[model samples]
Target chain A: MSTALLHTGTHENQTSLAKKKLLPYWLLAPGIIWLTIFFLVPIYQLISTSTQTQGYGIGTYVQTYRFANFMDAITSSKAQLFRSFEYAFLATCFALIISYPLAYAVAFKSGRWKNTLLVLIVAPFFCSFLLRTVAWEQILGEQGFVIKTLRFLHIMGAQGHLTATPFAVVAGLTYNFLPFMTLPLYASLERIDIRMMEASGDLYANALTTFRRVTVPLSMPGVVAGTLLTFIPAAGDYINAELLGNPGTKMIGNVIEARYLAIVDYPGAAALSLILMVTILILVMAYVKRAGTDELV
Target chain B: MVDASSSAHGDLILKNLTKTFGEFVAVDDLDLVIPEGSFFALLGPSGCGKTTTLRMVAGLEEPTSGTIFIGKSEITYEKPYKRPVNTVFQNYALFPHLSIYENIAFGLRRRGVKDVDDQVQKALDLVELTHLASRKPNQLSGGQQQRIALARAIVNRPALLLLDEPLGALDLKLRRAMQIELKWIQTEVGITFVHVTHDQEEAMTMADTIAVMNEGKIEQMGSPADLYDNPQTSFVANFLGQSNLIKGSIVDSSGESAVVDVFGTKIGLPVLRNHAHDSSVLVGIRPEKIRIAPAGTQMNGNILEGGVISDASYIGVSTQYQVEMPWGQELMVFEQNDDGTPPLSKGDSVVLSWSPIFTFGLAGDQDVNAGSEAHPESE
Candidate 1:
């Protein structure tokens, strides 16, 4: 009887322990289901479409398993893909340069005005994203105040127009994604204890040395987050190119959009989209590994 | 290796140094002279301007007026990096990204030291953290990080080393261990150390000279023993340890001693030691200085009769008694638990007595309860 009771007790303990171990997985089920339905399924469908051959009807494609479509799509539009990365890289660098000082000011120097400054950093996000991009076109127009001032200062020639140039496109991309760069940098910089700076000074490091050695390294996590946030969306963005850029500066995103919506080439668009997605994943993984912030991942 | 030139560094002097934040005075016209190669402490409660003073000396906060001289050089307006002073901040403030080795070498590298391997290794050895040299600060415990902060500053062989509550974050047991370790390091290096802390025991244990500050002013400055045994202010008497101050009026005064009356009892006070400016004074005696005896015992000076032990706590080393006097004032007395005598219990009849030498007289014109602010029990 005692042996039977012990057996039953052991069985109950094992079941309860199993429940405790599975509790976390049960909690994670909702997120996993959401990702599978919303993200994974669409990606799978896109991948399958990327391998499909062209069909006879407009906007209709058959799954013939033609993997050569990816190679053909990449070879045909390699310039646009390269240009897209170039613009995104330039925009990310420019955003970093501009946002770091702004973030630093908001984090350390604003003092009593910190809340006001942070709100202003995020103020652009409250407006419609497309509306803000359209506003940039007008701002960079030849007749606008900004161009007029540049003309007066001889920075731009009388015949020069910024409306449909690569400069205007990159400028618009930079302006549109600035908040993404700034907020993460601000969060990371703000988390740093001010005593660390004082300790640096106390340890006989000058202002510049301290900033380079202590402040910059400590804020790298934020820099990484901000750069990724800005670059990913900016690389995949075609709206700025459509509105502010000419045919010579067209990016891969614009090509993909044209193939899918304007020309009704589903297989070609899906192939380009898949290529862009894989290339970005590889680059992001490499960058994250080089940055040595697996904890952030 | 010791640098002979660094050892020859002179004293740190502050003359009429004041720091004001708009309408509020953080550090009032403070003047202090810290002798060379001495361990000095600025002890006070929070918001007492001890930190403000240390910051002014470190060149972190610019002083509103006056001059600061390290040795003979007037570093009043000098930049922090240019000054040959270093600090161990309250939170250790070790670089989160840098390894223990790099953190120790940071100051030396910044000052253009090309070869720092030996110095960094020496510092790691000094802190007994050589094995953890490759680990970042976050990987170390609080005590280890604190020692790293110290090693980082001292590796530069700065003329003056400032410590702003360096052990404030450690647990009690770890803090006690670090205190001895820090004191040993300071002596081994023989650098002038200025430590700021609100902990009395931490200060008393580490510093050769202690300055008790309150409200942006120094109440008393002396050796720990001098400050404790001969506190001139009521604030010092109660703040340092615990004091039983009794109100009294001086009846007769001689060269060195004065006769005073408390309730119905008479006591002799050392006039030379007292800084009283009025006829009325408060006689101060430490709790441990007062002896507890059975009621009706023949006692000499400063004896209170007809007192009952209102409360008694046997705290291992000593038995504390709160004796309620005839005049309704409670006087605390500590009797050492020696000779295995049976401890005193509450409500027992007792007499409180002490020698005249232990009695300090403060100006009675001041508040009798000036330093009687409720202090949190020390850990």
Candidate 2:
């Protein structure tokens, strides 16, 4: 009778345990179904399309497992691939250099104007991104006030122009993704204890030393986050290159876009996309490992 | 490592040191001289300007009007990094990104001192945290972090070490332990430590001399026992510990002592202890000095008769009693639990008596509860 009683209690606990265990999966059902249909299915289809060879004339392909398609795409568009990374890296660096002081001022010295300054940083976003890029064109373009002023000051010669250059493309990328670089830095910097800075001063560190040793190191998380945010999207972006650059400055994103939409080269486009995704994964892993979150608590 | 400078060190002095934020005076023309190698405490309530004085000394805040000197050099406008001073900030602001070892070595490294491993290791050993040298500050407990902060400041070995409520975050038991540890460390290092705190007990426990402050001014500065036994101001009397202040007026003035009358009873006050300029005075006595007894019991020295017990709390060490006298004032009395007498119930008639030597006189015009509530953490 005692054993039977114990067995019944175990049975009751097992039923409740089963329900409790299944609750998390039930809660996750919507996201899982969404990812499976919208994300995973496309990934599988992209993989399938990447290895196919042309079976007939236009828009027709067969499963030939043509792995060399990736090599062919890379060989043909390697310049664009390298250019994409170079532009993204430069933009990320410039964004970080510009945003650190901006974030610092907002975090520490702005006093009552902190919120206002943050709002101003995000104010450019109220307009559409495309409209903003076009506005940059008008501001930094060949006939813009900036170029005219530079020409008047003799900083630029009579033949100098701002549009259709690598500088303009990188500048556009930096301007467009600036907010992405700023907000995370602001959040991380604002959480730092002011007492820690004063403690650094008390420990015989001058202001510059304190900033380098304490402030910068403490804000590394934000730096990492902001760099990733700026770089990833900037690398895959084609709008800025198409709007601001000449054909020579085209990136891998532009190539992929032309291959898919204008040329209808499905296999080549899919192969290039996969290569870009895999390379970014490898680079990001190495970057995070080198950045070393081990120092953070 | 902190070098104890030899000839240039005399005292940390402030001449008319003042700090004002707009119209509100934080430190009002404060003048002070902290002798070298002494553990001094600036004890007061939160807004009483003790911290403002400490911050000025550390060069964190610019004084509105004043001159500060270490020996002969004026450092009123000196940069914090340039001054030979270090402060253990409140809440143990340990650098979260740095390991325990690095945090302690930060000062030496800033001064371009290479080979800092020995000093850092010594500091780690001093705080008994050498085993956790490689761990980041955020990985430590509050008490451990507090010790690391102390080690960091002490490792710099400045001429003056300012501790701003360094143990405020610790639990009571740990606070007691750290209090003793800090006092020992001060003696061992022989650095002039200026501690700022609102905790009266902590100040009395650790300080060689304590300056009791109120309203941006020093009410009294003396040894702990001197302030307790002969408090010149009502604020000092009440802030330092529990005091029973009985309203009285001088009935006779003599060479050695003065007699003050309380309602109907006469009490003797030592002439040296009298602080009143006129006949009016407030007679102060610590609670534990007065012994409670049943009415009509024969007692000696400054007896107040016709008293009834109003309340009694039988704590483990002592039984605290609230005694109501004939004059309609409640006087507190603390009786040791070892008295071998049964606890007195409320409304029991009793008379309070104590030696006249324990009595002190303060100016009667001052508010009796001036520092009672200002004790901040007084129970």
TM-score of each: 0.94, 0.96
Positional deviation of residue B237's Cα in model 1 after best superposition, in angstroms? 0.7
- What lDDT tens digits, residue by residue, belong to model 2 across residues B287-348? 99998888889999989999899899999899999998888889999899896789888999
The residue-by-residue lDDT of candidate 1 on A199-231, one tens digit each, is 887776778888998899889999999999999
Candidate 1 CAPRI grade = medium
Top-scoring candidate (TM-score): 2
- For every candidate, how close is chain A to the native chain A in TM-score? 0.91, 0.93
Which residue pairs in candidate 2 collide? B2-B157
Query: After superposition, which runs of candidate 2 have C-alpha atoms over 4 Å from their true positions?
Result: A1-19, B1-8
Interface RMSD of each: 3.9, 2.1
Model 1 misplacement above 4 A: A1-29, A152-155, A294-297, B1-8, B374-379
Quote the lDDT for B122 in model 2. Answer: 89
lDDT of candidate 2 over A38-92, digit per residue (tens): 9999999999999998887999999999999999999999999999999999999
